[model samples]
Target: MTRDHSKTFYFGSRFFPLPQRQAVWAVYAACRVGDDIVDEPGGGPVVLSDWWARVQSALTGRVAFSQAGPHPVDLALGWAAGQFPIPVSAFQELYLGLRMDLEGQVYRDMDDLELYCRRVAGVVGFMIAPICGYSGGDRTLEYALRLGQAMQLTNILRDVGEDLARGRLYLPESLLNEYGVTPAMLEAAEVTPEYCALMRHLTALARTWYAEGRAGIPQLQGSGRLAVTAAARAYEGILDALERNGYDNFRRRASVSGTRKLLMLPQAWWEMKLG
Candidate 1:
């Protein structure tokens, strides 16, 4: 399958200042590529396993199989790490989370859910926090972790139907049982009121977490703050879209259009610039 780089316009979006844009793109591209290896049609566990191995090699500056030629994601990640004081362990965390996707792991409870979120989203926050100059106490970092968890939870909630179709379930099992929702019900694309109520509750929880995430933005440094803010807002916007659609994600995939996104870019810029 052909890898499409066309959707990467955000990498060059004017919302990001020049200095950090390229480095951010490198990290985003790396993550997107790794994710696509699992997401592509006909891509299987063997393919994902191979990609992870490549990612590990690239992270250590030994890119033997990356299509990025001499400039592998790991090398780019290393450069980004140098430019920012991002923790190396964050990359490990992301890798661990991505592995879950390969195995179609399910969450037994909130604790399991938290671990998955840490792997996928928390590490992203860890990588980004230092770049935004948010270095302080463990409390500040704790906020970042919660911020990441909020985003990941939103994603899991929004993609519930899709993930189920893919033979994966991210909702906590306890919550499912509490609502009388079964994996089979989810797999069958049944949208009962209970399911809707559960999704509404989860989405509300995510919104609150994202609101908490917003508190850390002001603590960030200059342009980096704007970049992170835009990302956070843009992702939250997806949740809003889901709400507007009446949470019928099973029938329609929720998305913010390019025009809306374009408007958001300027609005976000003004918010950060004037403030």
Candidate 2:
């Protein structure tokens, strides 16, 4: 699922030991399906409720390795929970984020958007960190959450044009107004000076999150440190790609090429081990 759904994630997860990698894949599958519920066309409350029930059952130790029922994602999730101290609250928080989507709630400002990002993406870090092993306790966890938020923000920036076309806008209205970028300008896909400035502001904030996130990597144990380091560098490369395109997110999606990702691995390893 990771390979098929997300190449960037696959690239990072490949570095993990087989067991941890499989478990991470399970968590990713669970989260990915829930997100699909919100993003897929014709998804409604009924389908979401069924999905949520399976998650609860899986996390509570219900196992179904057969082809009978409970879904493949739930089975993998059940397996992962048995192997690790996987947090139930993380998925509960993710469910809340999906509910917000179902309700069509508007993000009032950066704080609101950050909360949304935490629910959907930050909790993912929470799920993955314990499996990776960390020594600094909550401080490290907080850094992981911030890292996830940075990636989420990166996704937001990359998907702005796509989201707007779907009649959805994740850009906080406050920032838009502050930058003198009107909704009309966004709707028209205009890459005006004001729009570029707004993008630059967000890019800077994402970079700060990335810096803080990297600080926690040295605190992680084993291959997990390198896994996260490579992932962070690869994801951060999207911000660079976006800048290279002159912040014209409307015309194209930002991505780091495979060659750049391969080049990042050794550097990520050296930085994590020595720096």
Candidate 3:
């Protein structure tokens, strides 16, 4: 089941030095493939079914999973898992999360959203944390989980209009009900004061989660703390951009440009070391 890492993922792995970089690239490549299966268009039920079955079999040691799917990412992940101490449970959780996406399940509330985030994003953190030499302490896992939640929350906020267009709503119904903003209204791209207020409220919550996530960086091993800091700060910057725009995700997608991300690296370094 061994395979070369995904090209883009390999390049991205250059941030780390030596063997750690190789290990991370393999994991990223696998995740990238799993992501493609769920995110890419034109994947039919049969294709997804086969992919899911292979993922399970590969993880369970029932079959050899090399680069045989629509993409080589999963094969790469299998190889990487075999070569390292990556958490298989986390990878399984990630696959299950993608399966949910394939089924087009929508979030009903924060609890549902948390479940989805835990499977899809939280598990990725868990998988990476162990690779980064973070022990499975409550504080470390808690921060990783919150970081994942924050990332998911930011994604949800950024993609609200797009998700609504595709008949998905991530904003908790209870909050929407409390605000008296209906799904139809959100679908119509209504940027009313109520909607704006709701978005701001949501962003505030995401910021809190990001703060909690950052608290556990000091506990990371090797250069992982720096890498995670860069990634987290870059993501947080996206949320900041959303906030600066008065919580307007409808007019344009919020992003932190490469140049800004470059600037963030130094800041992340400072936060990881001096701060």
Candidate 4:
């Protein structure tokens, strides 16, 4: 699932030992299932509740996943939960974020959007941190949370044009007003100077989170540290690609080629060693 849906994670998890790698895949697949529920056509509270029930059944072992219940994603999650101290609260928060998307909530400001990012993505860090066995505890988890937010922000920036086409906007209204960019401009796919400035502002914020997240890398155990470093490097490469594309996200999608990802591995490995 990771390889199919998320090339960056698939590339980075190559460094993990078998157990951690599989656990990571399990978590990702489960998250994907939730996202699919919100993203797929005709999904709503009814089906969303059903999905949540299955997840709860899996995580708490309230029902036998194999005997008459649970999706494959939940089954995988059940196994991962048994093996590690997976944070149930993280999943709970994630479901709320899915609910937000289902309700078509709009972003009012950075705080609102950051809260969405934390619930939807940052909690993913909380879920994975225990599997990797961090040394600094909450401190490491905090950084992990920041990394997830940074990645989500990158997703927002990269998908601006696509989201606009879908009649959805992730950019905060406050920021748009401050930058003097109108909804008409965005709808017209105009990369005006103000829009470019707005993109630059958010890009810098994501980069700041990336830097902070990287500082916590050495706190992770075993190959997970290198794995995370590689993931961070590969993911941040997208930002560089966006800059190179002149932030013309409305017309040009920013992506790091597979070769570029491979090239990043050596430097990532070196950084892991240096740490």
Best model number under lDDT: 2
Model 3: per-residue Cα lDDT at residue 172: 76
Q: lDDT by residue for model 4 over 18-86, one digit each (tens)?
A: 988888998999888888888778778998888877777777865345456556777788888888888
For 1-275, candidate 3 gives per-residue lDDT tens digits of: 11242222232344566667666766665666666666667665676667666665555545543565334545555655666567667877887787877787766677988888788777767767776777548789888888877877878888876776656666877789877888667767778889888887888888998898888878888788877787787777888788777776776778777677787777777888863
- Give the per-residue lDDT of model 1 (tens digit) for 227-256: 766766777777889988888888777776
Point out where model 1 deviates above 4 Å.
1-14, 41-75, 262-275
Total backbone clashes of candidate 3, pairs 3 or more residues apart or in separate chains = 0
Candidates arranged by TM-score, highest first: 2, 4, 3, 1
Q: Which ten residues in a row are the worst by lDDT in model 1? A: 1-10
Clashes of each: 0, 0, 0, 0
* Tens-place lDDT digits, model 2, residues 1-275: 88888778788988899999999999999989988888889787898887888888898897544467568888889989999888999999999988888888787799989998899888889999988989899999999999998988999999899888767788898999999999889989999999999999999999999998888888888999989999999999999999999999999999988999999988998998785
Residue pairs in collision within model 4: none
Residue 47 lDDT (model 3): 67
lDDT by candidate, in order shown = 0.71, 0.89, 0.71, 0.88
Error of 1 at 164 (Å): 1.7
Error of 4 at 218 (Å): 0.9
What pairs collide in candidate 1? none
RMSD of 3: 3.9
